[model samples]
Target: MPVKIRAATQHMAMFSVDADAAQAMIDYSGLRVCRYRPNRAVAVLMLMRYIDGDLGEYLEYGTNIMVNPPGSNESGMRALQSAGAFIHHLPVDQAFTLEAGRSIWGYPKVMADFTVTDGHHFGFDVTIDGQFAVGIDFRPGLPVPSRFTSKPQVHPTYSHLDGVTRETAGEMTLSGVRYRLGGATVRLGQHAYAAELASLGFPKRAMISSSADNVEMTFGDAKEIA
Candidate 1:
């Protein structure tokens, strides 16, 4: 019997913010994806990160602003009035996940879970707490100005099985996919995951690329299952 092959494409983005800020910015309005073949599958994913600053900034008044207040405005003046000098260690870490059209199939599935320690320390006081948002906008094909950007007719089925465990601080295995949560350990997984990643021009250490820019990563550790 002759063998049949199928192909899929994906795009993704991951963003992070601090906890002291009153609100976070998410701009997914500018994203693009290209189709490799006429009938190949495609999808996109986006990840967001949020960090907490400190309690002092949180307690201070006039930290939240409706819009970008001018530096010479009253709001800016109030922000400075309550400002104080303090040092705090803030956590900076990445979170990964998938966001794409439900109709598209054969596209790579994405997942990410981890904990971040005090990744950075800032001497100056800065508010970090705030609302954050992650947005996704995916279509088909490269740069083009036309109606109905062609998409593959086929839709791939995804199996979101879960039963993995975090056996160590730097590693977590879920549904046969191993994730290197931290440290220098590298993760590996099935060919489907690897192939999807390669087609999207993802980084070598990525288990999956959650966006077009490959900013978010789900590190693939040694798998316990085939």
Candidate 2:
């Protein structure tokens, strides 16, 4: 584990996408989409604001599809054991993180013009090359309290770059969490990636949404998986 995000905030939403549609997005990434059901798959849209970390301060927006763990092609229903994630598009507002992400773990991090605003609800907007990309608003839900220590929970992450596919163990823990049933809103823009998301059905009410006021994560060693 070389990269560490010591402190940050994470807000994310989950949506169910057509398994086939999800697969199409990551076909070239050498990762397999996890078909949780007969025809259903899952996609996660995550927003992260890093206050302190090895990569320094930065903001990141990611569109990711749930994936089947490497070396297994089981009948997609085994999502519990194969909770890997393959990032389809990742956007950041800083250059150093953009370069480090791509070079370190092969994360598909792209430069973007982005901002976050706080009020009754949270707002995030992004533009790429001066073209509008996406806008998202989140209303913090009820707080979930836990007295247990924040322990590291490892999850699989996949990335493909320069004709190489890598797998990493991303361990993270969250504190001061809150969740809402239907408080997330979004708008897609003219960016090509936005269009791609539209193809898979974006700008809709997510199945669920959650926000973590604090987060700590360590990106473990990356291994060639494909």
Candidate 3:
């Protein structure tokens, strides 16, 4: 259906999780957590502000689990290298985008409110279902080489909702990108979903955090994962 994001300011962070607890959080059929070790898994969090896009202006927050690609035996570094993600929770502020995300890609998108502070250092405060969820802040670390910046990379993502699982190869290109080791700070609040995220060892520093000022993305058809 042709989804494109023309300009955005986004922040992302990665965290390590106990694989068993992570797996219990997902509990989706046909999906396996990619263990970084015997019991460690990777969890990812992102906050994005889409200034221009086919879906219109909206804010989004996501928590995803690193997973083995469907039907693959890859594990550890191999699976990490595979770069496959399974969406656990996605919240957006726009109704149209919310419906579009779910109807088109089976994304489990829920309506939420966001308070954003934009700049070199970015902040996002998200409230879900009328309760405060999380407050996330990011600080830049070092410059990513120009060669690596503004390049398109297609990311494989899986989503299971309403008894349907779908895979999408979402591509993004970015500029003004900066990242740092342990660059993220998070605060948990009254929402139950916030507690759900806390299960993965939150209220702690992120292993890595990054921010980009201008970004572009594209999403095409979603393939059913058998």
As for candidate 2, its clashing pairs are: none
Local accuracy of candidate 1 as per-residue lDDT tens digits, 1-226: 1111122122322111121221211011111111122221122222223122111111110111121111222223233232221101111222121222111211122332222222221011112232121112222223332222232222111111232211100111111111121112112233343333333333222222221111111212212111
lDDT by residue (1-226, candidate 3, tens digit) is: 6688888877899988888888888877468899978898999999888999999998999989999888776677766988588998899999999999999999999999899887767788989878989888888678787688877888899999889889999898988888889988988989987888788778887889987878999889899978
Q: Estimate each model's TM-score.
A: 0.17, 0.94, 0.94
**Residue 56 accuracy (lDDT) in model 1:** 10
Question: Could you arrange the candidates by lDDT from highest to lowest?
Answer: 3, 2, 1
What's the C-alpha lDDT at position 147 in model 2?
A: 56
Q: lDDT winner among the candidates?
A: 3
In order, the Cα lDDT scores of the candidates are 0.20, 0.84, 0.86
Residue 150's lDDT within candidate 1 is 34
Candidate 2, which segments miss by more than 4 Å at Cα? Answer: 75-78, 147-149
What lDDT score is found at residue 11 in candidate 1?
34
